[model samples]
Target: MDALPFALLLCGVFLFAGAVKGLLGLGLPTVAMGLLGLAMPPVQAAALLLVPSLVTNVWQLLAGPRFGALLARLWPMMLGIVAGTLTGSGIIAGAAARNASVALGIALALYGLVGLLKPQLRVPPSVEPWAGPLVGAVTGLVTGATGVFVIPAVPYLGSLDLDRNDLVQALGLSFTVSTLALAVGLALHGALPLAASGASLLAVLPALLGMWFGGWLRLRVRPETFRRGFFVGLLLLGGDLARRGLA
Candidate 1:
């Protein structure tokens, strides 16, 4: 693709992804990777996501009131995420890179299906200390492999019985740490190119703009219906990616 066209496509993708995040409180990186992986290689798509994901998630992380407490509690899990990302990134950037799309597709499909089903899983306080780092490690492995970071992390966090604001902030903190670790992994593996990084930085503007628009829409529109529809759409997109990968 030409430079101008690619940039335009990226802007559109991030804009839509950002809107989803603003409206639903998450999904920017997952949605972006699912779409971008259709054309770009998985490694490049992952690299492009690093900057915008980090910036937006950091903003989300700081916007909440319980940042210090959450950080203190989640530190072990966050460390595990960093460790797993660094460990798995080499495989993602190596000969196994071709399979990244398939992995991402599978991740998205599972996420959407789970969202649709809405299973209620509880994590009792007794188990949280051990579970946190284990879940974070698994999530980071998936993040490093496929550039999708939700999986077990989101569900695990949701099961913690946090209030709404704390839950959102916790998600943000997890994503920020995951994105930073992925960026470092990509850099270490030489998978990130200068041009792609630059484009990612520039794409942040459209993403923020779309978030503003989605936030406005959230105030005016009923989001439950929209969220369901979004997940359904993601399910289809993910299925298509998986099919293509298998083909």
Candidate 2:
């Protein structure tokens, strides 16, 4: 495929994904991964989304309240992220393209529903200790393969009810550390090439802008309403991708 078209498509997609991330704090990878996986290989898709995901969420962490407290509480969740990334690498390197696309598209569609429907979805002060390893492992497997693994954990994480500031802070830290681990794993497997890396990096500007736009739009709507829009959009996008894969 022509790199230009893929790159162009990514910029447009990230505009929406970043906007969603800026408002809700975690839609970048979910949306971008689903769209990219249609053309890019899974590991390559992970690599492509990793950089922008980190860059765009920085706004949230920097401005968030109680950032340190949230970080302190997230050590276990971070552990899960690491484990999930490592576990996911094996799957990414091996997953068939069509299968990976369908799985990621479906996962993205589901998580978008959670974000659209849940008025209260953020991290809590306390969560199940075992939740980290089990959930993280599954997320990591999906992350390595599809970059959509984070969706499974989003509902639980989103329901934290930490207000907007601490919520984004927690997610920034979470995605940053975990996506970094995923990048390492992909690099080790030689999946992080110059083309994907360049595209991913180039994507950061639009991603950040989109996040800012979404954040602005967020102020205009209720959380559940935003999530509903996000969910419907994902269902449409996910359905399209699934059908294409089937075809």
Each model's lDDT comes to 0.89, 0.72
List, residue by residue over 1-247, the lDDT tens digit for candidate 2: 6768876888897887788887776678877877676666656778888788777656556766677777676677777778777767766666476776676677776665665565554444455566655666666666766667566565556665656666667767767776787888787777778887888898898898898898798788886677677778887777777677677
Give me the candidate number with maximum TM-score: 1
RMSD of each: 0.9, 2.9
Best by lDDT: 1
TM-score, one value per model = 0.98, 0.84
Worst 10 residues of 1 by lDDT: 91-100
* 86-130: candidate 1 lDDT, tens digit per residue: 987876687765687788788899899988988898999888788
Cα deviation in Å at residue 183, candidate 2? 0.7
Runs in model 1 deviating more than 4 A are none
